[model samples]
Target: MSFRWVAGRIALAMLLAAGAQSTQAADFVDSAQRRVMLPERIGRVMPAGPTAEVLVFALAPDKLIGWTRPLSAAQQRFLPAKAAHLPVIGRLSGPYPTAGLDALRRLRPDVIVDAGPISAERSGFADAIQRQSGIPYIFVDDSIERMPLILRSLGTVLGVGDRAEDLAIYAEHAIDALRGRLLIRPPNERPKVYYGRRPDGLETALPGSPANEEIDEGGVINVAAGLGRDGRIAITPAQLRAWDPNIIIAEDRPFYDSLLHDPIWRTLDAVRYKRVYLAPSLPFGWIDDPPGVNRLIGLYWLSTVFYPDMTQEDLRTQVKEFYDKFYGDKLTDAQVESLMRYAEAKAGETRRVGGEPLVGIGAALPTPVPGPGGVGTGPAPNTGLGGLGLGPPGRRVPTGGMVPLAPPTPLH
Candidate 1:
C-alpha cells in the first residue's frame, strides 16, 4: 500500500472510534458533584433506594428496571398494573443486605440513580456500586425544596426533558402555593404539632431533620423543633407530655389504633381531645419516610388540615388529582375518601368532643349557647386553640430553630 493511503486509512479508523465514543457516552454532573460519563441514550435504569425509585418512576417509568420494594396488595391498587408487577429489587441503603446486585449485572442497566440527601458515606456507596457493577451511578438531590431543579437536571441526564419539565412545573407550583400561604402565619397562630413514627409512636424526627421538612412546609409548628436534634429521636412519654403538642400526626396505623386505649398515650392533650391524626402511607408515605416527591401531596393535606378556610381547594379532589398525575392511578371517590379517612375522623371526633368547628384567622368565635342546666354550652375555656382542637393556650412550642444543614458535600 502507498504510505499516503495507509495513513489515510489509520486516520479514518481514529475518526470512527471518536465518533463511536461520542455516541456511547456523555459527561454530566450529579448531585454529589461527581462528573460521570453515562450512556448518551439511557434506556435502562436501576434505583439505588426507595426515594430514587419514586423519582425515576415519576420522570421515566419506561426506563425503570424495577422497584426497591415489592408493591403490597393495597399499594398495587394505586399503581399501573405493569408497575405493580415490577420485581422487588431491594435497596442499597438501610439495614437489610444490599440486594439485586447480581440481578443488576444480569439486567445491565445503563445507569443507576440514587436520590436523597447527599452525604460522604452515600457517595462512597455509590462509587463502590459503580466500581462493582461497572455501571455509571448518578446521585440526585432529593430535598423537597430542590425537587424542581432535580427533576430538570435529571431530565437532561436521562433524555426525558419534556416529561421532567412537566413534573418540575407541577412541583414548583405546589411548593410555591405551600410557602406563599403557610410562611405568612404568625408563630403563635400556627398549630403546634408532634409527628410520631414507627408502630410504637416513640420514634420521631425533630425539626430541621429532612424527615420533618413536610411538617414545617405545612405551616404547623413542630413541637420537637427546638430540641436541637437531627434525624429520628426516641421521645419518652414524659418528654412528649412536656412538649404538650396541640396536634399529633402519626405514621403508623397501629399507633393510631391504640392511641385512645393506651393509658399513657391517652394522657396527651392531642389524644384526649381527639386532635391526633393518622398520616396516609400506602404506596408511599405522604409525609417523610423516604422523603421524596411523595411529600408534595403531604404539604397540601397538612395545610388543609391546619387552615381549612385558607383555600377552597378540596382535599379529596386534590388527592385524586395528585395520584392520577404522579402515580398513574385514577382514584375512585371511595379510594380518595379512604385516603383521607383519618382527617375526616379527626374533624368528626373534634365535634363530638364538644369543640366548635375550626374558624379561619380573624373569624369571630361562635356565640355561647345556653345549656340544659343554663350553663354556657361552648367548649371549655382554654381547652382548644381557636376551636381547631389544638390543645390549650400558653403551651410553648418551638417556633424557629431549624438548623441550617447544607446539602452533603461530594466525596473526593
Candidate 2:
C-alpha cells in the first residue's frame, strides 16, 4: 500500500470516530430543562405515566413498548390492534410506582418519557429514575394550553416530526377556535358549570386543577371555584345547592343518572330543567381521568352543551374524526350511537330553556325509577335506539363489537 493511501485511511477512521462520539453525546433538553443524552434512534419507549403514554402513542404507536395500565375489553375497541394488546408494564411515577428499576431494565426501552407539569421535584424524580435505570428519561410539559408546542417538541425527540406536526396543527386549531369562541362571550355571560366526579356526584375537580381544564377552557365558570381548594375535593349536597349551577357535567354516568331521581339533585335547577350532561369516558375520559389529549374532543363537545346555538358542526362527525385520527379507531354508526347514548339529557327530560326545546337523539324512553334499594334500575335495552340497549346506569351493554363501558378507574 502506498503511504498516501494509508494516510487517507487513518484520516477517515478518525473522522468516523468523531462522528460516532457526536452521535453518542447528542443531548435532548426536555421541557423541564433537564438535558438527556438519548440514543440516536429511539426504538422502544416506556411512558412514565398515562399522560406520556397517550402522547407518545399518538405520535408513534410502533415505538411505544407497553401501556402504563392494562386496557379494558371496551377501550381496546378504540385502539390499534397492536396497541390494544401491548402488555401492561405498570407505571413509574405518581403515588403508586409499580414499574421498578428491574422492570425498566428488562423492558430495555430506549428512553422513558413523562408528560405533565414540569417542576423541580418532578425533574429531580426523572433524574433519579434515569440514574437508577441507566436509561434516558425526559420530562415534557403537559399543560393544555401548550399541547401544540408539546406535541411538536416530543415529536422531535421521538423522531416523528411529520406525525407530530400534523397532531400539533390539529391541537393548535382546536385551541385557537376555543379561544376565539371564548372571546365572543364574556366570562360572566358564560354558563356557571359544576363538574361532578365519582358515583355520588359530589367529588369534583377544583378550580385550577388539571382535571378541570376541559370545563375551564369551555368558556364557563366552574361553580366549585369558590371552594378555594386545589385538586379533587368532595363537597356536601347543601353546598352544591347553594352554588346551583347553570349546567352540570358529570364524569360518572351513574352520578348523572342519579341526578334525575335523587330528590335533592332533582330539586337543583340543573336537573329540574334537565341541564345535566354526562361526559363520555369510553376509550378514555373526555373530561379527564388521565387529563391528556383525549380531552380535546371534550372541548368541542362542551361548546354544543354550553352554547349550542354557536356550534354548527355535527357533533357525531367531530367525534368520529377525533377517534379515527387520535385513537386510530374508525367508529361505526352503532359505536358512535353507543358513545352518545346518554351524552345529552333524556328525551322527555328536556324542559324549555328560553322557550326552545333542547333536541336530543333517540326516542323518549321511560326514565328509570329507583328500585326498593334507592338505586335506579336503568330501563331495559331499547334495540330500536340504534343499539343503545341500556344495561345499567353509567354502563354500556356489549353488543356486536361494542364492549361494556364504565368510568376510568385509577392506574393502580
Give the candidate number with the greatest TM-score.
Answer: 2
Candidate 2 per-residue C-alpha lDDT over 1-412 given as tens digits, one digit per residue, 9 for 90 to 100: 5443343334334323433122244666666666778787778999999988988888888989999998899998877788899999999988788888989978999889897755578889999999987899978766566576566656766777667767866776676666566666433345567888889987887544578766656645556554432367677777788767778888887888788877877768787777888888888888887888888888777777776656657889989998888888899999989888777433233232331111111212223334457564443342221100111111111111001122222212
Report the error of model 2 at residue 74, Å.
Answer: 1.1
After superposing candidate 2 on the true structure, give the runs of residues whose Cα lies further than 4 Å from its correct spot. 1-25, 186-188, 345-412
Q: Write the per-residue lDDT of candidate 1 for residues 55-99, one digit (tens) a residue.
A: 888888888989887778988888888888988777866556457
RMSD vs true structure, all candidates: 15.6, 16.6
lDDT (CA) for every model shown?
A: 0.66, 0.67
Q: Can you give the TM-score per candidate against the true fold?
A: 0.77, 0.77
Best by lDDT: 2
Off by over 4 Å in 1: 1-24, 344-412
Worst 10 residues of 1 by lDDT: 386-395
lDDT of 1: 0.66
Error of 1 at 103 (Å): 3.1
